[model samples]
Target: MTTRARATVTVSWPEANTRRLARQHLAAPAPSASASASPAEAVGAMLGAHAQVLSAAELSVGLRGDGLTRTDVRAALWAEGTGESGRTTLVKTFGPRGTVHLLPVADLSLWTGALSAVPTGPNLFSKDARMTPDQVEAVVAAVGDALQGVELTVDELSDEVVARTGPWAGDLVMPAFQTMWPRWRQVLHLAGHRGALAYAPNRGRKATYTNPGCTPMPGPAALAALVERYLYAYGPATPAHFARWLAAPKRWAAEQFASSAASGAIEEVEFADEGSAWVVAGDTDFPDEPARGVRLLPYFDAFTIASHPRERLFPGTAYERALGGGQAGNYPVLLVDGTVAGVWHQRRSGRRIAVTVEPLKPLPAPRLRDLEEQVERVAAIMEGTAELTVGTVTVGPHA
Candidate 1:
């Protein structure tokens, strides 16, 4: 006998975007001085900000939290702990997709513990440059220990790591930006995901590494909770979408979603065209009004990267014009009414900024005014004042 399928709620793309934007603080900006939220908490609301280009990450967070400045974002990440346990409120480290992200220090346990579950990939380094599993283990241990009580520059960390492990750990064989990095550095993501190392504040021109000095919750529980959080933040999504976002294997992600659904932690729903997807068990409500606003998003913003159903999010010519060959976050976006309305670029000098926007369609006076205000806010996020220009943005991605 065949078992009956569970009832699934259907949601329109407009409704879905509305619900997601609300959850993400993109539907309406929260007053920064509401006495209810801090920058760290803002970062937490978005899960984490993609920080590969740290300045862009700052804009992503600052814009979501009205009145917040880039300085506020940095201070939240770099502030010293005043309480008995001296963990900074925010940490910059490897997060989802194995990319650098700014995560709240308090949630490091969840992120590290969850990320540790992502399966390791085969090494692509030259045979001689590769370290054996045993050697990798030794290097990871040494890197963690060397970082416990102090921060170390890559060069200094290299020396200690080599002394603690062996010369093999120091071999500059792993190729990087036209150069080779030490073999042991290959495990940097692994180290961060395991709660071993985190980024300390930059020292002069060099960045330093330090022990996170936090414990990761155990893997199984953390991984489950992570899936729940993702569903809450970006759900009505298939396991395939989740896999792509997490950089996890598709089969493994399928199992995770299945387990969550089986456990009643998430429920399946029918979302536009993607067939069935998952959302948090009780989070099916959506707003009647569409998400309406004018917002400027920075490169590699979390919203652009993680939201799904590409056709719906991209809409019209955005699929060809604004997107970088269909990938989100390569070019900064101009979002209006919860969809990609255009692309924008910013150039800053000293205390001034010039922002240019290219719209897919003509912006009415009201939207244009909103765009100017959005540009002003973005400049404030950069700690500058901006002049807005409505025309072609000739610069290429990340320019």
Candidate 2:
């Protein structure tokens, strides 16, 4: 009789053991956690498995497990410890169309969720507020019309909005644009992806805007492709995760997930805690353990938000604060051996990035050593020169 081989169960080891597992299953180079190996092997192994070098945008949406932010997604990649020199994060767009997200390039595709345009409905532009949906839609139409052939800064756009909808519109004007403009940007951005519209600079940093640059329609096929890409990178996630990340309705996210599943393009996985998560196997893979390295993830890395059950990875009691407050919540974290050990932030001293880390629990000596070494490595990678003062500062009461 044929018998199934038992999957190796590692009940106990150094927390860094995850790195070794990642190297074995994901083909990453075994680091000091195991035998010595080249970082290139680790990088190549992951890329070869995925069949492409994932961008942050793609990974944030693709990994789609839960509890991910554009920042958390990139942080996970850096924790993997296999990327080009100085490639801490990959700059890309988040939900506000062009809102920049600095994702780790290597694991960028791991957090792909979903994206959709919410109609200017009551749920979004509430009638209870001073601005009604119709009013918001009017401003959106006016803004869309005004920028039909030209780009404008927020100031310039605000002026155009006033001219189109009239100044008496009051709060309706600004809030309307705030609520609707992002939707407009998403439509245009998606169109750009479909080769329909070419993106043009509407203004500079404080004066930025997107002008219609193409005639391509971001139709179902285009959106489907994009959504598929997101699921592939950040799969085994939930519709809610996609909805929050993409700033779309739960219905829209559900539709996208369903559509992908109908085509047999997406698969679902059951977490010990988080029920089931949707994923695109063709576009997804996970290391047996955790990604290596002691990466100090910026606020809200996708790794932290890939699934609702992140508590499984980093228990909530570990830290006293939820750095991420709302939908745009961000929390800088410290990743040791593929798990979040604590939250960290930097204090600027002239030209230094004095990183202060607060672990959920008192760090053991070995892990503390690992964190110090990792911080030194990151410092060398960052400003070419900087001092790392570990355990020099403390914040909040330890519960």
Candidate 3:
């Protein structure tokens, strides 16, 4: 029997960036203006938008989708208008890396099943407060039972959990996000990953939780599905990238990659500057040229976070100016020719948004014009008038 060798494609850094721009819908004349006609399709395109900062997530979708407004994003999230058609088709949940994200409701099962399949190390609370595997399962079940067709705040759900599962679930308090959370609340994170819980519309300023009706796939199958999706959206990547993106252990990510490779679900490719990486099988198509135009991407934009080879994406001084100390989401980014060229911030004053661009180097007249157009687009999405200001780059405390 003859074995056929897989074709090896050597991709240049420029070519890779071009492909990323087009695939991510940032290319000039932007691919299929209709690709983002709705929030669900836009979120689905990027796999899911980073939503730790809710407003940024709204901008993430608004910038991608045609004629989408902040109100439209809200409508999709809170289901504000009509019957089934009035309700938002997206769900807010703790997704990749245990961070909050907005995912298409239809894909919740896949996200949950794949995320729950990973074994997150030991409990970080006291031994007495730590939940045994069986106890954790019970807590998850209690969460599902408690949240069925009802919305409850984290505090309220904690009470229900203790009632259903016992006091151990409430005895542990863990430090998180500058506040103390019940040790059992960790299960809530797992519940999100297991398709058992999702975020509901906030009650005033307080957040509420609800149950998403989904039956998650088993671990291995879910993992495969996640790997395929990751490759499709951000591939020509390495196991380390996948691990970092998902906050999964390196060993597990490597195992998944190996399994996928063996099954021919993905193929190994040599990427420029980054060497060996994996791309989805038969996903070798590249655009004829690099994307043109400037974009003011909000904090934690998928393109800013998903792209690998940080050096290429944030070349030279851009590394420090746009992503100081290897941290992202501290500041909004300025993308020029598919690379991080600067960082920006917006200040709003009654019906007006002033966007200040701090470029690493002076932009040409043409690029400045493009930047102006981007600013206008942002203002329109924000439903406010906008003004552009250029200033010396300064990293903020957040940066």
User: How many steric clashes between backbone atoms does each model show?
Assistant: 0, 56, 4
Ranked by TM-score, the better of candidates 1 and 3 is: 1
Q: Write the per-residue lDDT of candidate 1 for residues 224-263, one digit (tens) a residue.
A: 8988988888878889988888878899999998888788
Candidate 3 Cα errors over 4 Å, as ranges: 1-7, 30-35, 82-86, 126-129, 176-179, 393-399
| Model 3, C-alpha of 261: deviation from truth (Å) | 1.5
lDDT of 3 at 199: 92
TM-score-based ranking: 1, 3, 2
Clashing pairs in 3: 76-88, 79-87, 79-88, 82-86
Question: Can you write out model 3's per-residue Cα lDDT over 193-238, one digit (the tens) per residue?
Answer: 8888999989999999999888898879989988988888787899
Query: What is the C-alpha lDDT profile of model 2 across 1-399, one tens digit per residue?
Result: 965333232222222234323432321221343443222222222221121123323322322222223233344334334355433333232322223443223333332222223322234434433454466456656655666666556556667667777654434322443463322332233332222222233244453444332232244554565555555434445777666655567897788777877777766665344455565645334444445545554443444444333454565653335343332124556666555667666654554757777676677787777777655544443432345555523543211
Against the true structure, whose TM-score is highest?
Answer: 1
User: By how many angstroms RMSD does model 1 differ from the true structure?
Assistant: 2.0
Better of 2 and 3 by lDDT: 3
What's the TM-score of each model vs. the native?
0.95, 0.59, 0.93
Give the poorly placed runs of model 2, Cα more than 4 Å off: 1-116, 119-138, 141-152, 168-205, 212-219, 281-286, 319-329, 364-366, 377-384, 392-399
lDDT of each: 0.85, 0.44, 0.83
Q: How many backbone clashes does candidate 3 have?
A: 4
